[model samples]
Target: MKQVFKRPESLIDVPAHFCPGCHHGIIHRLVAEQIDQFGLRDKTIGVASVGCSVFMYDYFDVDVLESPHGRAAAVATGVKRSRPDNFVFTYQGDGDLAAIGTAEIIHCANRGENVTVIFVNNTVFGMTGGQMAPTTMPGQVTTTTPFGREVATAGYPIKMTEILVHPTIS
Candidate 1:
């Protein structure tokens, strides 16, 4: 019989470790499908960020590199520049992309690197025990902000996509 229920050709056989309601698994499958549909599986290079999805390399059946905490963009830039023919992409979370790697993301976007970024914004830092992240909404309660985030002290969450569209960056 034909293999109709088998996993996608661009994804690994192993099950993901994300939470039941987490969207990482869906995003991973979408990326994998895109890689296969676009015939880029052989020439795709994925950069895994250091957040909950850090183990993204284990799920995709392609070349993957793990970036240091909040450095996926920098690593992706190098990979894309080094192999212009290959399709490079980065998987990052709100915390990884909006916090420690903020400068790197800004610089990479400003340079207009030919890379796709899959940014997952769940508000809080899921991997690090749900701490308040730069993307966490104001008044959101997290492990680090048990009493809800205070705009007066913690400041408002960073709007990454909006920032990326700035004239200087876009």
Candidate 2:
């Protein structure tokens, strides 16, 4: 018999600690597949922020650096600059990327940094007790917002990466 199910070499064989129904585990698997497909696991350097992906180092068998909340892009930028040969990427959340690290990501994008950024925009902050995040939908309830988010005060959901999307960035 032959083994038909083969796990990505970049991912470790172990159970993940993500919440039930959470998409982190699935997302990690996809990222691992891409890393393996590109054969860049040896040179991949993952920058993890203070969100759900903080434990990315545990799952991916690659050099990973923990960055301050919302600073993963900034840290990845520096790492890529220092070692251009290395494949650098950042795994960030809505709160970290859209709210706190807005400046860093914008600058990083504007400068056309040669790095990959995986942005997970879950409306609520799952790791931080399900608090409302920048991408939280209007009228959606969260721990931070007891009676649902009021559109008048909270405004609408912010799509930070929308400005960066284009046919080509050069």
Q: Residue 109 in candidate 2 has what lDDT?
A: 86
Error of 2 at 74 (Å): 0.9
* C-alpha local distance difference test of each model: 0.89, 0.87
Instruction: Point to the candidate with the largest lDDT.
Output: 1
Displacement of residue 68 (Cα, Å) in model 2 is: 1.8
Per-residue lDDT value at 107 in model 2? 84
Model 1 gets an lDDT of 0.89
Tens-digit lDDT track of model 2 for 1-170: 99988889999998888888989888898999999999999999999987786878789988999996889888998999999999999998888888888888888888889999999888887787999987898889899998999889998988777865631465
TM-score of each: 0.92, 0.93
Q: Write down the worst ten-residue block by lDDT for model 1.
A: 161-170
Per-residue lDDT over 1-170 for candidate 1, one digit per residue giving the tens place of the 0 to 100 score: 77666566899999777888998888888888888889999999999998787878889999999996789999999999999999999999988899988999999988888899999899989998999999888899999999999999999988899888772922
In model 2, what is the error at residue 162, expressed in angstroms?
0.4
